[model samples]
Target chain A: MLLILPIIVPMLTAALLLLVRHRGVQRWMAFLGSMTHLGCGIALFRLVQSEGIQVLQSGSWKAPFGIVLVADTLTTLLVIAVGVVGAATTAFGFAGVDPRRESGGYHSLFMVLLMGVSGAFLTGDLFNLYVWFEVMLVASFVLMALHRTKEQVRAAFTYVTLNLLASAILLTALGLLYGQSGTLNMADLSRQWSTAGPPPLHLPLALLFLTAFGIKAALFPWFFWLPASYHTPPAAISAIFAGLLTKVGVYSMIRVFTLLFQRVSPGIYTLILVLSAVTMVVGVTCALTQRDFRRVLSFNLVGHIGYTTLGLGLLSPVALAGSLLYVLHHIVAITNLYLVGGIFLRVRRTTDFASLGSLYRTHPYVALLSLVPIFALAGVPPLSGFIAKIVLVQASFAQGVYWAGGIALFVGLLSVLSMARLWDESFWKDAPDGVDKASPTWKQLLPIGALTLLSLGISVGAEPLLDMTSRVAGDLLEPSAYVRAVLDGDG
Target chain B: MELLFALTAGVLYASGLYLMLRRRLAQLIIGLGLLTNGTNILIFTSGGLTRTNAPVLAADALETTEPFADPVPQALILTAIVIGFGVLAFSLVLAHQVHRSSGTDDVGDRQ
Candidate 1:
């Protein structure tokens, strides 16, 4: 029952929120619901850790035929991250989201979004995954266009159109896949694929998966919609989008590549590696060119996805663990940065660096809060981001993937430059006269404080996190158990 | 039969892409609809079409007998169509809003 709770709690909350008329009730309910969802996620993680992967086949239908949910360690970890980020964003909405947006079913759409994300993480069937993607896309597109500002509607349009194209490709790929193999279950696909040798149109199918998920993840060339659109939303939406949304794409790639299509082609990995390096370089460099603080952070988010996919591209245990670590580090650091961006907006009354200044002069505490995640993100030591980068670099070097290692190091440097530009322009310069002087409310700070503490906690307790990732990486590298868990070796 | 379906899907896809690249919102929406239907037919054909049977087992028949069309692809396509319809409806509404607010549906005219 608890296995199903993560999806259920949010859906139920969202539905209930729709009926309630009072704003305060809706707000507290959304916050309480998010915390409950987090509790379920942490418990689910513990259950998976103690017992191994958990599977639920809806309506007693067996795998390869029924709708199935499997919570392996990787999925479990991502679920926990989702819960943490979801809760923080919901809390942040208290201070940041306009009441009009809330009245427009913002909380409901948000829960549906989480439900989709969780379903994607948990589902065993490929078609089920597609359905979940649609769920998430509709929710996110609506959220992007919630304000119906011209810029936001434009952003939503681009985001929706590209994503729908990606969806068509994925469906077509599934058709091709089912034409060849009779099953859609991930575990079943893995077993049949290995037993039958490589099927026809394998590379094309893999490329289809890559194209679909790539747009979602904002990998390299397909990443334009991301930076173009992500900043259009206000901070709450941007924070969650920056954290959970693209990571699902990365997760799907990691899951599918490892479970069903391991070594589908060495050519694919080479393409991935090349694309990832380019993604990293382009993402950070573009961040340097942006003067708007949120836009700079959004660009940074695009670039950092390269590192997680880099782990998948390398396809080694230590490297995968490092990539896994990088993702965890990123979810906290990036989301928190956006939340802090809201604080900056509140204090300075603007997001543009040219007009924004002197946060350090008056609100040193907010500046200090912003600094923690910024440094962590730039791969500064003692932070989880530094540890994640070091591990990835070490793994690349150990595998003698010199190009990957070099680029990881290079991106770390450029990251510092982008972050420092924001700090110097926004915090170091003197506050311009007659700007709005209201400090951040506790409602806003509460979420920032929670996420700031989360980043610190992940760093301080980095060992357990690394251990869990390495353990999960082992399973991902050798997925026999995962296949068995899903398929049950049914004839 | 398979070849005809394949050709139709291809032509629809090509046209869809072409129309989608156009600036007009109505054209793009039509393109999206065509693409959706094309993919639906593609899945149906790829799953191997059948003329005479639903995927039901006869009463007292424990198993699906004598080459009923595979139901899964139909199920998948139906899901896609429903989802596509909802999305198309939303896209149309959004387009109307875009046009009303911005006074043009040209992609270039969007903010």
Candidate 2:
């Protein structure tokens, strides 16, 4: 029951929210549901730590036959991060979203989206993963188009088309893999390939999965859909997408590359590293030219995905740990940044940075709250991003991959420059002529304050989190424990 | 017999991609539908064709024996087809909305 609660809680919440008629009651119920999800996630985190990796085979059909839900350290940590983002974004949406859009089933779709995220993280079956991806895609499609603006309709075309293509590719990969291995269970496939050597179609299958996930993760040359569509939605919706959606793709990539491929291909690693370097360069450079507030963050989100992928490419324990930590830090900081953008949109009625300014002088508290995510995202010292970058660089240098390490450091500098530019234009510059400015209500500031405190908490608790991620990296490197736990427990 | 299925899938995929590459919204939806159907056929062929055996167990038997058709791919295809149908329906509605809103079906013209 505990194993399924993460997905079930949101499912039930969305259903109940849909049934409720009163707007005020619906808002409270959504908040209650998300908080319950957070509680379940924390409980699961505690359970995983005490019990090691937890696997639940649905319907008692055994591991290779039935679907399973596995919550290893990596999955649990991501679940917790999703929980934090979900709760914060839910509150932000309540305050920031227009009443008409909010009434158009926003709360329910948001819960369904969280349910999909949890399902994607926990499922140990490849086909089930595809199903969950569809769930997320459907919910997000409606959420993006809820406002029904001309720009949104245009962006939704690209978003829906490209995402559907990716899903189709993912389905093809699953079908082919099942044909090759005769099983869709991830652990079973990993065990078969690890013990029996690479299957005949292994390379093609791996590349297929890469292509599918690459589009989802917004990797270089495949990321055009993200920046085009991400800025079309409300800030609350964009905040959640910026926080968790692409990370799901990264999570799957890390899971597949580590478990199925076993990190044995030096050529593949080099390819990923080079691709990641190029992605970082391209994303940050594009971000530099963006004038819209959320567009800049959207492009920067793409660049940061490159950093996490770089960690995956390095494949060392330290590097993978860094990758996981980088994902966690990005989730918190980026979501907070978007919430701050939401406040700007709420008060000033626009997210175009050129027409926006003087928040540092006008609302010192908002500026102060904004600085935490800005500096954290910029990899300033003692923050979570800094520690994660240091670990990745240290791992790359230790492995004698100096060029990738150099690019990582160089990209960090570029990210800082882009973020500084954002700061100067949005907060530090003088207010534009004849723009109405209204102070944000307390409800709007509350979630931002909570998320800022959460980011600070991650910084302060970095030591234990790093230690936990290091253990996760160790398990991912030698996945025998994961396989044994899933396969053997069935008997 | 297997070769026929393979050829049909290939044609579906080819035509689907060709149509999808066009700028019109209606063609895009049609292409997506064909593409998913092609994938379904691909899975069915790749799972191996056994015309005489259907993998159904006898009343007294606990499990079916060899030479029986594989049921897993059929199950997978069923799920995929359902999901594909729903998604295609959603896309159709969205494309109609786009056409009505923008007064054009050419996706390229929107930008």
Candidate 3:
């Protein structure tokens, strides 16, 4: 019951806050709800570590008949990540969005989006996952369009259309899976998949599922919608979207590929490997040409997602662990950088690198803050990002995938160069004329500060986190434990 | 019967894909509708067809039964139908809003 509360509380709060008329009250309520949710997530993490996996069967119905919210080690970590990021984004939202420009609807829609994201991370049923995805999409649509600027409206249309198409594909896939397997319960599907011989629909079913999640994860060909649409939104929303949303796609990819699909056919893994390499190279090359700070970061995000997919493509335990840890590290680091960029935009009044300069002189603390995560993103030593990349490269080498490892290392070097470009162009040069001298308020600084502190914490605590990630990878690779827990409802 | 359902699904999918590729919003809506119908039929056929019997048990029925239509897929498709309807309605409203705001029905023009 307690395992489910982190998801439930936010949803209830989101619904409750929608009824409140006052903007200030709504903000505070959302902040409080997010904090409580984070607290619960931490508690849930501890509880899972102390006990084992926590399974809460909704409505007390049996596993196949009712929805279940299961919390394993990986889920516990992801829940905490979602909670922390959700809370930070909410606080950042309060500081960044002007309630006068947009109604209190921003806060409300944000809460709803938070609820939907948390729900998607927590649910254990396939159809229920679709429901949560829709919840997230609806909230995201409203949030993306809240300002209703011409650019935003146009961007939102593309975003909505692509996601809706993905959702349609997802539905078709689900229908096909249910038709063949007669169960939408994830645990049951895994069981049925293992024992059942190759059905007539196996290849098509896999392709359908792959295509649906491929769009969300923004892998090679499907990723164009992302860089095009992301830059049109406000900085705060874009930061959160950049940090978390695509990772949800990556999460689904990891979940489905490992737990559901179980084994990637040799040919498919080759294709995936090729896609991962292309995604990495193409994304960075795109970033190299971008002059806008946000656009550059957005393209960089696409490249980083490839590192995660590459780890999975390697199929080594260490590589998979590295991928999971990289997802966690990237989420924190990228969110920090994006939020810091938001502050820069606030001060400089533009995101174009040509139009902005010399932030280190006036806002030394902000500059330093931005520099830490940017270095980490470059895979500089003593940061969690370095440890994650080291593990991935070592894993790939151990598997004799030297080409993949070499490309990954080269990509890491390119990332460093890209971040250096952002630093040299934005913070190191002379200040632009007529720029505002206003400092970031504590409200704006708080979220970035909290996120930066988290990145440093990851740096300091890299060993323990790595150990946990390895254990999670081991469990994921041998998924009988997960299947048993979901099926038998035991720890 | 299975062939009929399969053909219906194929036609719906073909037309749906064509409509979806069109630049106009109305065609997109029509495409989505057709796509969903195709999906529903696919779901129906994937569950193996039965002669005439449904999977419901009556009070006066015997314990033994044969040749019943698979109830599971029907239940699953029912749920899919409701969800599909929700998505359609949402998309319609979304398209309408985009049309109203942009004063254009063509996706290409809006872009």
Candidate 4:
């Protein structure tokens, strides 16, 4: 029951919010719902830590036959992270979302999106993962279209079409997997993978799954849809998308790469390593070229996915820990940066940096707030991103992949340059002519304040997060406990 | 029978891929539908041809004997079809909204 509550709480919240028409009541309800979700997340995390892995089978059906919800250390940690982002974004959405959009199921859809994200993180069946992806995409499409502007609609076309293709590809791959393996449960497949070597069509199936997840995670050559669409939505939605949606893809990739494709092929790892380097260079360079604040963040989001994949590609326990840590830091920093863009939009009345300036003069507090996440994102000293980068670089060096380590450091440098460009344009320069000079209200500052505190907290308290993520990484490299806890749930 | 299903699925996939490459969003929707159906058929065919009893056990027996159908693939296909339908419906509506707002179905910065 505890294992399933994280998915259920947000769903019930969405259902309840859908029925309530009053915005005040709705906002209060959303707050209640998200806070309740965070409670569940923390409780579930501690429960998993104390009791070890937990598996909840649907309707008392036996494992390998039932739709099971598995909560391992990695999964429960992801749920906690999702809950953190969900709560932060919902609170921020209160002020960041447009008034008109808010009245029309904004909170409801946000709750549903969180449910989709958490579901994707928690599901134990491949087909169920596909369903959660669909659920997420449908809500994301509607959210992307909520603006209903001409440009937004155009962006939605690319977003919807590409994600639909990715989903179809994943579904087809899953079908093939089921046909070949005669089981959909991940634990069952892991068992088969161990007892028998790579099953029939294993390489092709792995490649297909890689392609599908790559698109979702915004890996190189398949990430165009993200930059094209992620910026058009309101900042609150963009923040959540930054925080969870792509991370879902990373989570699944990690899960599948570790469990289903356990050989850790040097060929695939090299492929992924090269792609990570390319993605970093391309993503940061593109970010440098973009003038719009959200667009730059979106492109950067794509590039950061490389670090996580590189961690997985390294296929070492230490590297996996680095990747997991990088994912957590990147999610918080990226989400907070987008929210800061919202505060900027509220002040400047435009997304273009050419027309927006002097935010430091207008609101020094907000400017300082933005710096925390922006510098954090660039991997500055004493911050979460910096620690994560050091871990990855050390792991690469330990593995004698000096070029990968060098590339990680180089990417960090480029990331700093791009971040500096934004700082100079948006904060250091004089105000452009005729820009709006509105200040953010307390309502708007509330969520930003919370997130800023989180950013600082992550940097200050990196030790616990590091220890926990590294432990989860250890679990990821070993699968018997995962398989037994899940399949043996009949006990 | 397997060859026929495989061939038809191939044709559908070819046409779907073709339509997806076109510039128009409506055609893209059709392509998406075709792709989903093609994949569904592929899954069904890949499950292998079975003309045996269902996996359900007899009233007096604990489990079915050998030579039963692979029920998992059938169940998976059913779920896929349902999910594919939902995605199709949503994408169709989204494409319509794109046309309504952007005034052209060509998916680019043409708006």
Candidate 5:
């Protein structure tokens, strides 16, 4: 029962939002629903922390037969992050989004998007994950095109087409897996693979999974759709997308690689190591050339995705823990950055760096607030990204993958350069003659402040979070406990 | 019979990929349809083909005898079709809107 509530609450909220026509009421209800979602996520996280992995077989049909919702440490942590980001996005949307767009089922679609994300995080069945991906995809498609501007329509076209292709590829992978293993349950497949060694077709199937999830995660070569579309939506929509969407892909990759593949192919991990290095360098490099605030952030988002995968590539307990920590840090910092981008967009009527300036002179507090996430993203000390990056670098060095560790350090330097450039252009320069320098309303600042504090909380509480992630990483590295819980352990 | 189904699926996949590469929105959407259909058939054939035996069990028997079609792929295909339909409907509407807004169906020229 507790396993399904994170998904169910949003599902119900979306339905209720659709029924109500009043925009104001719908917004309030969505906020309430998201808060409730955050509460449920915390409760679920606590339960899992105290009492091992929690598994609920849907309708009591038994595992390897019925669909299951499993909440291990990794899943619960992401759920809590999703809950936090969702609540912040909704709060920001209230003041950030246009009234007309808000009336166009914004709240409803937002809830559905949350539901889909939660479902993706919680599902234990492969096909069920695909369904949740579709649910999220559909809602995101409508939300991106809600304004229906020409640029938006064009961007949505590219986004939708590419994502649908990824989905088809994912389905093909699922079909092949089921045909090869005679089962779609993740634990069952893992058990079979471990007992008999991987099948002859394992390499192709692994590559297929890599391509499908890699595209979603916005890895090096397949990340074009993300930057092309992410900046086109309202900042609130893009913030949520920035916060949670690609991370879901990383989560799936982690889940599939750690749980199902389990070091069967050293070749795959080496390949991932190479890809992640390129991803990190390429993402930050591209971010440097972008003049649009959100576009710069979008490209950086792609680069940071590489860091999460870096841990998975190493496949050590410390590395996996570092990856999880990176994910948690990235979600808060990136989403807050985009929310600040929204405030900038509202003030300047444009996000282009060339046309916007002097925010520091007019709104020192806003600039100060924005600096936290910006520098945090750059891996400055005493922030969440710093600790996460340090762990990954330490793990890579310990494993003697010196080249990859070197690349990680190199990318961290590039990230600092790019973020500092963004600060210099957007906040410190003289204001263009026609642009507005009016301060954002207090409501707009509230969510940003909350997220900034949350990022700070991650920094201050780094030791405990790192400890939890290491434990989670331990469970990921050894899935016997997870498999047993799913197959035989009580809900 | 299995060979024929596999060939059909391969053909669908080939045509789908070909059409999806075109610049036109209509062809792209049609290509998406073919791609999804190709996936469905691949799933069907991969599950092993059965010409005569349905998945239905006899009234007196506790389990069906050998040579029956696998019900799992059929169920998976059903779910795939429904989801494909929803995505298809959405893409079609979005394409129409893209056309109306841009006054062009060529995606390459839209940017």
Candidate 6:
């Protein structure tokens, strides 16, 4: 029952909001629904930590026959992250978006987007996962184009086109897997795949899955559409994308690679390691040169995803735990920065760093708030980001992959330099003559302040979070518990 | 029969790729449609052919039966078909919107 509410509450709220006529009522509905989701997510996390694994077989059907929803430790953590970020982004959306410009459709779309993301995190059936991906994609398309500017339209086109193609690839892979295995339930598929197939088919299926996930996660060569589109959307929508959308792809990649396809070809890991290196270098290099604040942040966003994938490719328990911790850290840190960037844009009325400066003079609290996460993102000591990177680097060293660790450390330095540049250029420099004056209201500070406080709390409470990540990583590596629960559930 | 279906699927995929490489919007839509159909055929062929056998569970059917058409792939293909249709409709509308906003049907012409 706990496993189902995170998805159900938002979906029902979205439907209800659609029927209502007033915009204010819809906003309240969205806020209430998102808060309930967060509460449910925390409750589910506690339940899963106490129990082993929570499974909800939909439509009263059995595991191999009906769709199943599994909430294990890993899934629980992801759900909590999704719920936290979802609530924060929703609050940001309410505070940041202009109701006159959005009117009735914004609240409903926000609810649906939350539903799609939560559904993706929770569903256990392969085909059902695809359905949720489309649900998420459709909502994202509508949200990305919400403002309806020329650039928004063009960027939306690119985003929708690339994602639809990726979805097509996912469908093709699903078709092949179902035809080959005769089961779409993940547990049954894992069991049958180990003993039933010839060696030749595994490589193709693995590649197909990798390609689909690679595109979605914004890996090196497959990540062009991300930077092209992510910067043009509203900052609130971008915050959600940064926080949840790409992480869903990472979650799928981790889930499939670790759970289903265990005997992945040896060379593929090497390829992934190299790609991670290139992604980190390229993303930060691009960030170093960008003039727009959001674009620079967008590049850094892609760079951090590479760090997580690097940990996954290393395939050590330590590395995997680090990856999980990094996922948690990056989700919080990036969303906070984007929210701060939103505040900056709201005040400055432009996204370019060159045209704006000296925000410290006008909004010293926002400036100080922004620095905390920026320093954390730079992997400063005694912060969550530093702890995540230390674990990741140590894990790579344990596996004797010194080059991968070295590159990660070097990239960490570059991330700091790029962030420092952003701080200096956007907040510290003196405002030029004839620049537009800022008029910031207190409501705008509420969401930014909330995110800032949350990051500080995570940084201070890093030990418990690290322990939680280790436990989750252990569960992910040995998914026998997940498989057993799915197979043994009531039909 | 299997050979014929495989050849047709291959032909559709090839033609779809060719059209997708073109610059025009209408051609891209056509390409996507053809590609989806080709994928459907590919999935159908991967399951192997069974003549005069169905997956329907009759009242007295045994658990183990010879030459039964695999129902799982067909179920997967059904879901894929609906999803493909949704994607197609959404993309078509998006293309229309793009055309209206940009006043061009050629993807290459946009800056």
Query: To one decimal place, how large is model 3's interface RMSD in Å?
Result: 2.1
Report the first chain's TM-score for all candidates: 0.98, 0.98, 0.97, 0.98, 0.98, 0.96
Clash pairs, candidate 3, are none
Ranking by DockQ: 5, 2, 4, 1, 6, 3
Tens digits of lDDT, candidate 2, B1-111: 989999998999899889899999999999999999999998888888987677998889887866899988999999999999999999998988898888999989955
Q: What stretches of model 6 exceed 4 Å from their correct place? A: A96-101, A196-199, A433-437, A489-491, B57-66
Which consecutive 10 residues in model 4 chain A have the weakest lDDT in total?
A: A262-271
Better-scoring candidate (lDDT), 1 or 5: 5
| Local distance difference test scores for all models | 0.87, 0.88, 0.81, 0.85, 0.91, 0.82
Q: Write the per-residue lDDT of candidate 4 for residues A131-239, one digit (tens) a residue.
A: 8998888888888887778888788878888888898889878878877887878989998878876676887888888889989999998999999888888888888
lDDT of 5 by residue, A367-396 (tens): 989989999999999899999999999999
Interface RMSD, in order shown: 0.9, 0.8, 2.1, 1.2, 0.7, 1.6
> Proportion of native contacts found in each model?
0.51, 0.55, 0.29, 0.69, 0.63, 0.47
Looking at model 1, the pairs that clash are none
lDDT tens readout by residue for model 2, A1-491: 68799999999999999888788788888888889999999999999888888889899888999999999889988988888999998887667566777789989999999999999999999999999999999999989877777899899889999999899888888878887888888899889987777668877887788889999999887899999999878888899999999999999998988889864455777777887888998998899999988999999999999988998788889998998889999999999999888888876888898678888887889889888899899998888889899899889999999998898899899989999988988889997752646888778789999988988988999999999889999999898899998999831
Cα lDDT tens digits, model 1, A34-88, are 8898899999988987887898888889887898899988888899898999999
Looking at model 4, the pairs that clash are: none
Q: Considering every candidate listed, which one attains the maximal DockQ?
A: 5
**Is model 3 an incorrect, acceptable, medium or high docking prediction?**
acceptable
Instruction: Give the better candidate number (4 or 6) by TM-score.
Output: 4
User: Candidate 3's residue-wise lDDT over A381-415, tens digit each?
Assistant: 98878999999999989999999999889999998
| Ten contiguous residues minimizing lDDT sum, candidate 6 chain A | A433-442
Model 6 chain B worst lDDT run, 10 consecutive residues: B57-66
Q: Against the hidden reference, what TM-scores do the models get?
A: 0.98, 0.98, 0.94, 0.97, 0.98, 0.95
